[model samples]
Target: MDPHQANAMTTLSLFAHARALTAALACFGAAAIVTASGSTAHASPPASKKDSKAMTTSKPCPKGNLERSQCMIRLLLDDVAKTYDGSGGGGISAIRALNTTTFAVSLPQEGRIDVLTYEFELHPDGRVAIKSRTPSTQNVGPGTGK
Candidate 1:
């Protein structure tokens, strides 16, 4: 085997590992922010201790603009998971701040077969007010390309 090929393989493995680690870290950060901040998935906070633990705590956004934006994005991901069907598992592909209160986020495809992107408008408070489900063009994938 060529030394170049071996190097390429190792590089690819490292890249994959890095991506996995980043995903895991993001999930953990979001969970901590949600759990410790008092954000709830339901209408209101749970009354009992057991039920309270089940709820996502919500707190005011961080004072720093950078921290606040990150918090909002994490909260938005939690909201997106509610409508996601566990397809693709790619998570959020892109997010753009359209305005002070509105953001356009690109969602992962429904399945591995399709490369479609769904864009939605999410508020800074993590409330989804608008959603667009239009598929773009035919996605090209390995072994499925024409």
Candidate 2:
């Protein structure tokens, strides 16, 4: 695929990952508050009263070998978690190679499972570019998602 198409696919993949992560973290946060309250049932805090705008942000994919690419992705995931007010569990669960130029990574933390699959290719300039991505919930099974 052309570089532009590859970048578009990569962006979609990242978006899926971030959306799942955000939802999972939000659920976890709500659960934590409830558990800490110790049976004193309380209503969830109100949603933001002000208008919320979507954010469009991008960062250059880290360069180098596959291992280094995996490391960089992991660190980026950790940073994203923190941005959503969530904590990381120190490391990811797995970064499995799907092929010589593709990988499937799993990040399990705080009872949630997130999986990101992507193909990477090295540009002529030596920068690693993600060719495509498909992110989903790892723990979700058939008969779920009602």
TM-score of each: 0.39, 0.37
- Model 1 lDDT at residue 5: 31
Summing lDDT over every window of 10 consecutive residues in candidate 1, give the lowest-scoring window.
7-16
lDDT of 1 at 114: 23
Q: Compared with the true structure, what per-residue lDDT tens digits does model 1 show for residues 42-122?
A: 212212223333223233554443344444444344444434443444444444444433344443443342222333344
Residue 12 of model 1, lDDT score: 8
46 in model 2: Cα distance from truth in Å?
35
